[model samples]
Target: MVSSKLENEPTGKKLPRIEIRMLSFDLVERVEIARLLTDAGYSVRNELAANFDRFESRVMDDDWDVIFVDARVPYDSVSRALDLVRAIGSDVPVFALVDSHQENQADLMELGIADLFTSDDLQRLPGIITRGLEASDDRKIAIEARRLQNEIEFAGDERAVLAEIGRLVSSSLDIGQVYDQLVEQVKILIPLETAAIAVADVASDSVTIEYLSGRELPGFDRGRVMAMSGFTSINQLPQFVFVFDTELMEQMRTEFPGIRELLNAGVRSVMVAPLVHRDEVVGFFATGTSTENAYEPEHVAAVEQIAAQISGALANSRLHIHISRIARERETLIQIGRDAAAAHDLQSLYGSVFKNLKNLLPVDRGVIALKGEDGKSLAIEYVEGLDIEGLRVGDNLELLESSTAVLTGSQPVTVDNAANREPFDLTDGKLITAGLPSTMRTPLRARDSIVGLIAVSARDDRAFTQDHLSALERVSNQISPVIESLSLLNQVQSLAAAVETTLDLFAITDLQGVTSYLNPAGIRLIGLEEGASGVGVDLKDFMSPEQAEIVSSIGLAQASETGGWQTEISITPRNSERPIPVELLLVPVRNPSGGPGREVTTVNVFMRDLRDREALQVELREFVLTVSHELQTPLT
Candidate 1:
């Protein structure tokens, strides 16, 4: 029946062309099958005429999409052919020819055969083989589609996970909370025995653990954290891992020699990613996996994305916390300023500024100093966490000559590595000697003038960002005004000395007639006790009944507007038993201006001795009378 069907098939364009490889033990059967398939418009690669030893080579030379294995051939030969196909990694499908009596489908499937056809089913062989070829092509397409879909899904999942972590980090303003969430989320995504984040302490050339996840690191020290050498340094942490194999000499020589022992010590495979901010490698995240090839390219890529988010989040969180701290400190410092304003003692104000700064900023030690003449020395005024008696306050320390050379020169200065920089002192070295590694010094400036400086020291080696620098600048800027106010009062005291030369009793008062400045002459004239300061006394307290009323009225009018008055009044003299009349002159002293804002105004009073003026008048009258009498007598 199979032979009749093959013969009846027309060999024309209407019928599909099929290539057949017929394997048979008998030459007659091979000839019959070939003649039938050829008559059916099929090409045949018959191996019956070939020797068994050269059969596989002959079959391999032909590029048939399917191979038919005859049951008559030795099972070992068929197995060898299947092995060859697999070894070559060919996509060709193998079908087995079997008898109905020996229908061992399981055995054919186990032998790596694609399908089986019995001798009785020979009539349907062409169609079955054609369908098998089509099915094989479809399977290939399906497999490729699945592989591509897997890759796309993997990439999309990575992006989604990274986005979720980013959202989680940004939603929280708290740094510790963000870190905790980051660690937990990473664990949920990719389970690991231990994970930790370390940041580069650039000043010290070491990385500190910023976040930790999973199991506690074995042999982890609290006071002294775990550190890695060459491969684990901040500069090189971006590399995933460099593995070595001692058991495989070829692998050892080909990759990493003498590195097997290093891997065996809880360092089989290390996955590391760097955290970058402002173009700097601030830190790195690392995890250790026990399995070889534990981290693939996709895993590394995911970690890199997470690390980027962590870098940005940490930078933002730290900045936020820093701003919050600075704002609180600013409020406290402003309160201190208000308190200082009410004080007459400069010592109190200096104490308040220093105390507030030390309490607010994270510092192991601090010092407050002012620039001396020639810009050489820093006159230390206040200090904390230092040996006070050992340090001199007013002595010259010989600092930088150029204002531009100094870091804290009318601007906030931060020295991350202070010990390695210029104008830094190891003299007292309490900071350096105490193993302090970081230092920041900000110059106090008021109205563009460098009034003083504030220095903070830390034991940790970390560079200050622009924000921290700005915060310290603000703190110093706030205190500069207080220092300027004190310095102004000192200048006023020196000017008061020159005013003492006027014995006519000069006095300076505020807009309210409150005597703010009184020279030695005025103090003595008012019968004030010796060495008594008259800063708070009113003009009415010093003047006699008549003089007080006249001075008060004129002082009030002058204080309101730029007005002056000259009047005569009676006053009780300090050294005399009688009441002496005096002449008083009042003038409103306008502040020097024309640069920025409204100027300050004060009242200046000048007093003249009335007794002396009266005596001179009497003498002039007597001289006139004498001259007149003499002239009249001569005329008569």
Candidate 2:
């Protein structure tokens, strides 16, 4: 019959379960031991083995809190059972039950026994098992505490490194310096065989390796540019990627050919984090090692933090560069305006414009065209760095699709590839033939009308961007009015040249009768000295007082009323005392809008001296009178 555990024991508490493995040759001894452990308020499962084979099998098959051996069994057998338990590497406590005279204490102790139990003192076995199990629990707790301590230290070190990296990012806007420091700091936490930072250009769909360090990688180096489609696919990465072994590296080789280079350089692990700013991934931060499974989850988290810091620094750097470039562009624009205003002619103005524009744009060729007088075509006024067969200065080009678009859109237009344009204009065709592929054109507007177009071209495709176009538009707005003014001035200069050579006396005066200009003939007719200007003289000073009154009251009044007046008038010469007769023509020049109630700008006076015609009439009269007298005397 099985002996049950004592129910009404001391302390009135439930017993604990104890699993024991015992090696014994006698059934009586195993049953006695089992009964003692059960009566001590312990629930016990005892496995009794009678042979070494059985004992070794029990030791290998199941786990026990303790093992027991009867010392009465052959000394060698007991020793062998203990040796088997030791060889299997079990930590179970092995206790030997001995007769008091069976003296093998020193030998059993040498064989690694936990304790000795005499048959008389077998009541202490339960307490010994409790002590042994308690010691095991303490060991487990110590091991877990050590693990937690290591983790805390690692966290502290990681935080310190992250703080250092954050400080580096904040202290420098130079990304190169930041990257160099970042690699050094990250090395404290993660082993690195290769490190790189690449910036993405979304407009061009490309990635350029901006910074590279560590082991040299073939086909992956500083300043290397690769298309984003089949390359690293950095633009498509989600937060971070870890290629932790050679097998994973090979699996990623097809999608990311850059991985092959890493593998060739003996790299077996890689960690990549996207550099994100303002919810956009602007670039990537990557690190690799030659050891497989070199990075853990915590290392990945650290790299992500580093990448975030880099992203912020890169954004600040880019913003700084952008602002600096804008400030420079603004200064350049101011200088261009000054050059435009100070230029004396269109050629000089174009030269200055071209020179100043180079500071802001990549211009390989430039052209300026004005709307034709007919308004259906454009006349090429200025051309620089462009030499096409049929296109030259003073050449007429029909309004084509590209130029028409600039005028109609009333904004800047960009041709990314001049060679790819359909229905190409003469300018586009010429540009393609010249291997110039990029072009930006902006309309020149003045007084709310599209007056002309200014264009710039480059040798590379997609060389000009929206920013460049915007800059060009700003320049166009600044110089368009000046161009119009210059053109008008040129026309006025030409008209003045023609008027200067005419034989008739021409004089211009303000509405107050103050003369502002007098041509050569007018100067000679009024008897002014050679090389003397007639400006600031009163028009009435050249006429007799009576004639000045009539001209001021009647001639000026009629000219203002009917747009012109013509009559014979007497004008006293400055060097002659006699008054000379002349035919006077007065014309009123009105403001831009000439209608009733319009303001007069100036009065133009044209005069032809009549002295020679009067002298000829006197000669003819004298000859006729002499001939009549002669004929009458002959008749008497």
Candidate 3:
């Protein structure tokens, strides 16, 4: 039989050769295929269709444009050869050459054969070759197009995942943020039914499921710790890929069921990548799909890259947390320093420390204890925002504890738990009664001497770190100077005797008009007996009726305004019927909280008698009047 072979030209010029390889059953079919393609301008060759293994390699290796197979071969069956090329993952097309129709002829067509040809149709051989070349070319173009599309889609998905990863690295609050972003991004790489990230704690010999996304598996809430050797085995391997049928899954469950709960629900295939940083395995990211054999090699590689990124991201998150904590501590101490600088008394100073305490450190309840005036005990000087039984202001306790060491200029005493153990005995029952189980006592120092103690407390299990102690030390340092200044007030008061002994009359008064203290000179000037009771008397009572009303107005106005005012006024002494002149100066003390005399606490009054000046003025007036009357007598 001869098939139609269309000749191009008889012009002796050789056409470009088209190469062809054919799989034939016997010698007859081999010669037929060779001549058919040869007359059609294709250079043809023949191979004995020896075995299905060699058949698959040749077709899949891209050497042939079209493969022609005989319906029967000496050693192997046609159906088996066709199955090798199509049922598996090869893309080359195969056609069958049938000699006669059989009972299974229709069944052979359904076995993924590309086309069928019979011996009677030998004339159509050239047509079949022409059509096969055209069809193969079309399929190659389509496959190339699909491959490019997949690459582009993968690239787009990578960009989106990396963008989200950038956000996680830059703004992550905790490791949980990194976990959240990692699991969500894993689903983009493959068909994911469920995904999880589990971190292994070596010391605890446990695996902690840190984050999970998609379908929830029973007994796999976050933070659940499992005692399993599977995580240990996973850590030993850099990566593990598991694909299971129902039988294999059951086998795995029997072998390692302890960690089976950590696996994804309905998982048929899963890829696990180790989260490694600096050569240490910190955790693993598990991505699972319910579809059988769903994960490919490329998917495993993609998950490996994500796990690597998460390792670095987690480290950065910890650094960010530390930096934010330091920044907050600095701002809080600066505010406390400003408040302490304005404190003029111990009470306001204590209030400022407590108000800003929580800004720098955790404080649920706090107290400031200082050595009492009794000199043998420490007293509760300042306390609030805490409900401690048997503790109040002025309550005394023996100063024999680690806090007493603060009086000797020692470091602060700290306790992690107050119920069973504490640094000092004096703090006994204080924490349990206050509902606080953690306590820290920082010393308040003035002029290199311990002036008081600051105690901060929190709920049980609140462990204070060294960083927290450092921050508290910064706050205590800022308030030390204010305490030093207040502690020196007794030395300041010792100078008052100098003012008292001077000939000047010095008096001190409250914001009201009544005098609080009167120097001896002031007492004598007001006609009160020396060392007599003049403290309660108002200065207005000794002034003449007109001067009293006028100077009283001047003094009241001086109290209302800040600074000082001075005037000379006449006063009728209580012991004498005549009025005497005196000089008076009123000065308002500074208000601690700011502004002018609105909150002023006291007024300072200085007085000096003007009796000598008034006597001289009277004599001069008499001399002037004498001369005037003499001149009016006409100088005879």
Candidate 4:
């Protein structure tokens, strides 16, 4: 028999509201009984005139804690009504209303009437009502306990299936494998016609179907992709990105147009839940069933719980991939630095540094330059990214010239939108023209002076944080000292190997004005006598009258105290018309006894006819300042 009270089952609140149904032979008695019951806080539904049809409807539609049947009704008519109630199921504990003077009370009690009571003894009605409802409530509780036991057994059978699919998803890190297992497992657990896994694309902010299973529904485009903002995913998905359930299939379709055709094609139900990571939606799972009312609230809730558990695992896998790529790039940079240090020559250093770094870092171009004369001008030793003629080799770009300003300070300089700024440096112009909206330049310094620079550019308006800037700074710091050492080693090797063939003058002197060592050019420059030997030869003997006193007073004295000194001294050659201004640098040599005794010192003297170079530098500095000031006028 179909359960008639399926929709009207008493919940916790209704359990205490006593309900009574009155079946009587006449209208007056039934009306009186209903009024009395209602006044006593009992809900009463009456069926008068002994109509068996009315009684059956009342029994099927209403939840009656107690049934009041009049014993004065015709036997056959009343029996028919009683028989209908019996066929409907379960003993409802009917109480037959009898008069105080009625005969055969014991027989009536035995005739399936749980209790018989007169109308005059209405004081006992409250107790009867309470007892009946309690008894009915007890029966309902037992029925629920048995139903729950059956559901638990069914769920146990499905556990094995759920476990197998869960194992597959957990073992496979590939997204395709996880999606395939999801669809297959859902089909086994619940009867469904269609299923799909949709993941959000970070770049586009759109959702695309990564996996789909089951046949296409008739008269509909079953597997059509929905836009990210559409109803297919949002209506079914919970706002919390964890778990939720609802059973309004028809209402969902009416609210979202894209899924209307699917609903009309006998696919009446759907459930969806988001796959979340770090409190954000990474993806989602959606399912559709062809049978009407296929998914209950419990079914939706279970699917949501499973999605929540697996989302965190998938997020971990994604993070691992990102870290692996970054580690590989760092290793490649270390190898390049090592290779450059091994070059042992300027040309080799240029080739290794440029070629290897281009492969290691993502950039459009690079240039290396050395500071010339008090950080005034930079000589471009190497250039990459375009034709060589496009770049001016030896020139002074300003200290605050666009993103390349890293050479002026020990920091990384970044420019996100170079085009918006007026008067930008042209070396990075190609990157801007090609739509590279961001750039980073790292300074390479030696002995606290900017020696060179390394730069990288990108095509997106990306914000680079302090961490990225610090990483580039660290990379440049490690390479700068190694580069300086390699250059110094090369200089030492060149001098030792070509000593005999070198035409440049070399000289060494003792602290007491005695000449210790001199090459052939040094002897010719000073016009030394043929008989003069190295030992006990006063270096003051080579200098003219004025030069002799200047060296004795200033050169040797400062060399002893400061360990090194430099000055320009006038040299009057034998036939020269005017005194030659020769640049002299004195380097102190360590004493063999390890004391502060400056027994020997070396001086490198170079004579340069720099009558115009000094004037040009002054003119260039004045021109640059004037132009920069003029350019700033309109910008303000």
Q: Which is the better candidate, 1 or 4, if ranked by TM-score?
A: 1
The per-model lDDT (C-alpha) reads 0.60, 0.74, 0.63, 0.56
Q: What is the lDDT of residue 364 in candidate 1?
A: 67
Please give the clash total of every predicted structure, in order: 0, 0, 1, 3
> Lowest lDDT 10-mer window, candidate 1?
627-636
Q: Which stretches of candidate 4 lie over 4 Å from their true place?
A: 1-330, 345-347, 354-361, 364-430, 458-471, 482-504, 508-520, 523-554, 558-602, 606-636
* All candidates in order of lDDT, best leading: 2, 3, 1, 4
The residue-level lDDT of candidate 3 at 610 comes to 74
How do all models score by TM-score? 0.46, 0.53, 0.44, 0.42
- In angstroms, the error of model 1 at 83 is 18
User: Can you give the lDDT of residue 245 in candidate 4?
Assistant: 24
Q: List the residue pairs that clash in candidate 1.
A: none
TM accuracy, model 1: 0.46
lDDT of 2: 0.74
Best-first order by TM-score: 2, 1, 3, 4
Q: Which one wins on lDDT? A: 2
Q: Write the per-residue lDDT of candidate 4 for residues 1-636, one digit (tens) a residue.
A: 111121332543342434445565345655666666667655444444245666788777755555777776555544565677778884777777777877766766655667776777766766776666667678889999998986786577467656766686678666465666666766656656777666654445456565677866543232223455555444444373321123455556676564565666666666667887776777777677756666665566567666766676566655654475467547756765777667666556655665655544454555666555455545666655543344445544444434444465433223424544433444546555556545666678866756776555544333233335555566667667766666556654544343324333344555555555554544555555554443444545545678767766787678658755556666654434465555455555544434456354343232222234475445434432332222211110
